[model samples]
Target: MSGNGWLRPKKSRQKLRKRGLDNPGDLTTISSRSSIKNGPGVSVDKDLPPLPPVAPLQAHRLKYKEAHSRIDTQRGENRDYTALIHALGLEDPFDDDESWPRRERDEEGERPPGEPVVASLPSHLWTQIAGYLNPKDAVCLALASRTLYARLGKAPFEALRRPENASHKLALLLTLDRYLPRHLLCFPCGKYHLRSQPGCEKLQPSDALVRNPVFVCPNARNMLRRAPRHRIAHGWSLPFSLVQLATRAARFGPHYGVDVDALARRWKGKSGDSEDGWSHSTRFLIHDGRLLMRVVSQCFAPPNLSPSGQRLLLFSRDDYFPYFSVCAHWRDGELTQVCKCALTHVPEELPRGPQSIEAKFKNSLLMGPRRPTAATAPTLCGFCQPMRRCPKCPTEYLIEIKLSEVRNHHHRGGVEFRHALVVTRWSDLGDGSAPSTSLEWAACNGDQAGAGYDSFSRLGKRAISGIFEAKISSDNTGIPGRRIMSMNPGNVKGGDDWY
Candidate 1:
């Protein structure tokens, strides 16, 4: 009917009549329909009617509601009723069905409901819990139960190895190991000495110094005689010096000396000795990779003494000068006197508050230079007179200490001697030159004698009022080949006798 043979108003009737089809008016003719029905294609059921039209709005809404209800019912069949009820904040409506879930009771292995869950946990779980605890608490827990002990195994120690637990670990190790002597060498005898207890069966002579390792040896009696110049055996005194060093180090750090109190408390229970006029306390610490110690001792005055007797005992004398001295023996066989401070009565005006005695002691001793002047200068007596050499030579690097009593006033008074000790590396002292007239030389020689006896006495009393201290530094150039012995007035063996 149209130019492309599609239906058009003008030619549609003519075209249909020519084709002789009853359905010509329709775009789909009878021949096309017949071909489609019989064509080689997928089969369809002509007998079934087309699906009904989409339901109306009300019917559609009703169908959706029914489907949703069915789904909810199915879900409820498998739901956790306890969780659901709790989430809904509802009480149980059915007595037969409890809302709280309970584990099926196992009569053979069941624990009491009130017991801690920790006790029933596996070993691995307990170890995990212990990993969170501090080493000390973990150790205590381990000791409480055999099962926990077995489970903990080395976990506590491993935990201590961690950086966070370093302080606790150090305290434990020090507490356990402190019984071992600090130094094994006997200064006088030059032999290893183990500490001996009251009933210790170690073979030794009756004259051996008992109850202490540094003093324990067959030749202990010869200590005073061997180094007669020094009042106590240099060997026996080394342990005390180490104690002084440790005490000083502990005052600054947390770990090193904390165990001292614990150890002291333990010792108190074991030693039932009565309180006496003389008291001694010692502590040790490790600082900057070196051992430190501190010792505090109280020396009470004799019961009674006349003025002359006091002068003889307390005044400057050749046989004994009351003071404390520290000497360092280098590896190169150089024994240098680092510090020599007089021991005098504590001043009445000085404050003794809650401050640590160790800190005060360290402060008192560290008042001097790091390097000893005697190391480079010519050795002289306290009077500035030339001195002699030591009788015995040191085989190894070591430290020597001396303690004695000195007068604090011209007139007779109650006498007391308190000493504090400290050790430090030589490098800590700066490169400052020694003064032309150092306190060591001035105090020894009384060069200030022009100031008069009263002034000198006051000066001497002030000098000896505080603690004695010493410092050691690395001498990379090594000690000089020429060895010079200390010329202390306390030296009774040889040297100028002026005091």
Candidate 2:
């Protein structure tokens, strides 16, 4: 016996079995007889009935076990692709289960058709009713029925087609949202355009112009009527079509648009001429009929940066906005100040020996305090160390200093530990309505409504960052950190160098 005191029991220490007792061989290779040996096989293999060829494999994995299986079916026998989904006896992916009717039926039965009663009403009554209605409503009422369409004629539609009533026409077109699943409302053209790429549409790089079009538009090249887009970061912007796709799918069914997972993305930022660079990560979630967005931006920091150095590190040269995502009210808040404060916490190395004669004599008497190194943990002050929500918009921010392993191409192992400044932002992008109309969408862009966007009133107690983080993480208890507070307590903006 090998005398090792810590040796485990023989059963526990034995190697994995070569052939699994809990498994069964392939269906094609199974023996004609049932178990002659005492050991039983997988529960699935016992008393299993024979199945048709290639049912277990996917469409991409199809192969001919027998030549008869691949008969081209000129005699009309091929079931084609109706046949991985059905073989597994699963419900069709495109099928709508609930399938509500266009108009609600009464409790007694379906609503009685009233064509006779509608026809009995004089034509002048509709004209009288339409006179009190707006262009949008008038057009909708006229088209509601065949009887009404004949009586109202083309007057309401002609009125809506006028240049001044364009908004009314657009509103009228928006009503087709329920009817058209393969088309998107084109705002600039005021029409429903067939989706060029349809369900497979993908978000592309801001610079990759040709790869991003969902539907072709006549006004695409017209500078005055460009596509609506929201800025995500320095060079990244999300076009409105993608939002329409996501919301349409959520509102209707899977076939209507792409999954929300299609929008989640991770990408690196460009490091141009300067050594200081940023990396941005973004993900999306839909909650309460509203789309939420989270962006995390991080960059390595050196110790004891000057005012100019901080500016050079944070802001971009072209537009002056930071490389991270931010709402319209960024400048009015304490966001920049909080970043500068975190930078101050990055401890700078001090000289061991005192230069002055009095300091040298004082140091000789007692040993100096323990010196701080680059790896020392940074401690942030109260003013800058809490979760902050933008008082103006439905957006929140959290700034943190974390010790991260950075990759360096020049280093031997191509890795080194460094302190990085991480800024994370969460914004509610609204209920996927028209960009100009949705308050959340407009507010995030700094488009004013009356006084201004009051995020406290709009979002209430629910912090977007907290809700978003809780959703993706394993734990559902809640965000385990500091209480959320206003980003700018003073509500001050402009004219200050401190920002």
Candidate 3:
């Protein structure tokens, strides 16, 4: 057995040289599959065991080269490239499962102990770090951890809810806290003013939040300890502004705005008394027992109204102006902000469709106090008139409201106001569509109160109108035999005197 370490091609050296072929050239190598025992083969038979899957590096193999040589070179190159890739831990292209090594934990194992337990800290600690991150980064972190996502629910709500930060507040308001357990996460404020209802009391401790030592707000601790309980009917109108309404509409458009950052800011940091020093709140007049306050700015607090009804209908940016009123009996329950609507600058043509419409307060009069009256329905043939000045005499009061847009046909710039009186139930104005007869006002007196009149009329006409209205609606005529009085003639003497 005369043996050679390596086999040479059968072609003579002289012939190969004549053909200008080199060692790497196509004709200089063996062609059979068995010749490539060290590398992948070009299987000649369809039934032959499948050649090992082609290595990615084999894509560059020269087709004209001897099949066995090409396979051997490709196999060596693929092995080297694969080792390099494996060292870097790059993804295996053919793998269906894309999971990669967890870099943090992998690196942790490589290091000695006492370096730092960064990788294994409970997820909550990571969330606390995320909280301090910018919004974009915080969102990334939230997506990475289910635990972080839970803790971050409405996390940014506080940032948007502060008074000066109304633009953001509007954004949060329009959002629904879908993550919360109750589908509701009420951010109760520390202190607020209200119009007094003599017999009402504050909420009980069980009904409100109890003081928690861990709470960030100092006042919350004291409030929790007091477990304050008192009746609540009326006292102060909530602090809401026009600005907040407009921004809300802009931020949310048609989407949800529930954000934790906004709630936290409004609850823990911002208030009516903010650094801006702008008085964004005002005390509105209570006419006929109905509270009225117009929203007119960009930054403001949400109003507080008792929830006495099932569905609270809020109108945001109504007809370009933001206006809201509660539904029937919503006021019978404790005060809480339900759904938030985005605020928007008044549009040119106020929407008149279903979207602009809201539930009107039922059994509520827009204005007028609750008290007994003297004159009863004229008793047929016999009568006893109660003393007009008796405590039972229903006190009559009037309030005038006027409104003009920033620009109007009359050249008035900014909002303009006209006046009207808060008249008691006096008459039925044709249809039940009178503005003063809105259900909000009805809550105070319902059908018992009369329609209100614009602050313009001759004295006799005013007196007659008031008398007729009061007699027909209240079932009482005049103050203890005194004839009804009309509008003051002095009010219409001249343009300057008009109110």
Candidate 4:
């Protein structure tokens, strides 16, 4: 019951243990028969097919090689497999190695041939460069090479379509093609001409016409047919004197006096010669806050005027100042008669009696040179004196005229006489000095006609002592009137009047 209970005798075991107790190490080992029995379907060691005959070392290595080959084939098919491999915490084979070929070093340290030397730019950059060129230069460049031509053929035209390129296009046209067919289109008749000519050439006979050739279609037949009707619908054509007066007023306004020689020189450039026996005079004033300029001339004439048999000729083709009206008056002493030549309709009989003459003169003076029956005549004449007055305000007017004379040789071997007349009107701008609102007339016999008509016309030769007077008067209505008063020689001012 103590050390050895079941396997050895209880009392005798102590005595046997002293004798090694049946070999204690042997007692710890159990017999084969006492081992646990194998379960059903269990196999002996010899029945397990001898462990599949242990594959050869070379065969095992072959299996590993086949797996590596499949992995490499799949790596090319799946582009992202390498990245996936890296994501899975696998070491990348190419991480430390150079993906591209390393350039071989030379003593000069030059770049290798693996990469391109010059980089190619986009097409838009070349177009931007072309855009910076001038139109003419660009056109030339486009024509220089076929490649450039293909690219830039329409570039110049396309650029002109832009609003900012308008000036460029105009400059090109003016410098390169001033007489282009498109510029020769006629404004009034909407016709094109083969070449430019003076408008007068078409209207008058070659012997009676004198004008500078201009860059406009001058269809003489059309002008002659349309001129009279146009005048009737507008007003009498202004003489050279009045035209010069208006031009001066427009150039200098009311502050400066007109200088005839200076103006001629300015217009004619350095070609004008004062010794050519040309003369001019100008007078100016302010009326009802409007500026008025008058110019008179003698001997020299404008390009638009030429000599005819007994009367000075005017082409009456220019329509620059459509709103202006023209009047002509001639008097021999107290006797005055309105010239019927410039009028639309000339009366066969003259009015008799001093009162009737005065009334007719007044009517003609205010009505301008055009006949009263003319279609262009205004319902109320601008120069008419008003009948009523405005109590709160009053209007003031001024009138001035200058006479100039020049003596030149006529083809007949006698001294030729020339005269000019200029008139201007001004309106107050609430300032002390009025600015010019309109230039009435600046006319010269030298410019409009060869000389004074007195020697040529029967009526002019019958005149005794003549005077030309320009008067300004205001009525109670605060409206002012301008009239050619008496023709007495004493009433006419000399050329020095402008000073």
Q: Give the TM-score of candidate 4.
A: 0.21
Predictions ranked by lDDT, top down?
Answer: 2, 1, 4, 3
In TM-score terms, candidate 3 sits at 0.17
Error of 1 at 135 (Å): 4.5
Give lDDT: candidate 3, residue 199. 17
Query: Residue-wise lDDT of candidate 4 within 1-499, one digit each (tens)?
Result: 5555677522211111121344445322222222224334333244323322223443465577675654546445434566667765665444433554454433245445321311143346546767788765666556555566555558766776566655455444433322332223232333334333311112111222324222333554465523111110122222222222223334445222223222221111011232322223333343333333333322222222223411221111233211111222211121111111112121222333334556656755776432323332222222222111111111111222122233334332222222221212221111111011111211111113212322213222211111112222233232223332223334342222211
- Distance from true location, Cα of 464 in model 4, Å: 38
Model 2: residues >4 Å from true position, as ranges?
1-113, 271-276, 349-375, 412-415, 449-451, 494-499
Top-lDDT candidate index:
2
Candidate 3 per-residue lDDT, tens place, 280-374, comes to: 22212222222222211222222232332112222222121112211122222211111221111111222323321122222123423222223
Q: Among these predicted structures, which one has the highest TM-score?
A: 2
All candidates: TM-score:
0.22, 0.70, 0.17, 0.21
Global lDDT for candidate 1?
A: 0.33
Candidate 2: lDDT of 302? 81
Ranking by TM-score: 2, 1, 4, 3
Q: What is the C-alpha RMSD of each candidate to the true structure, in Å?
A: 22.4, 27.0, 25.9, 28.3
Residue 498 CA error for candidate 2 (Å)? 6.5
lDDT of 1 by residue, 1-499 (tens): 2466544323222121122244355352323223334444423235544322332443566687675553446555525566566755666444533454445433434546433554578788878887787797787677766767776787786776777765565445434333433323333343335533322222121233244432356764555634111111111232221232233224434322223232121011011244222233333233333333333333333323444543343322433432222222121121222222121221122233554656646755766312323332223234212121211211111122222244448523223232222111111110011111122212222234211222223322221111112221243333233232332324243333223
Candidate 4 residue-pair clash tally: 51
Error of 2 at 411 (Å): 2.9
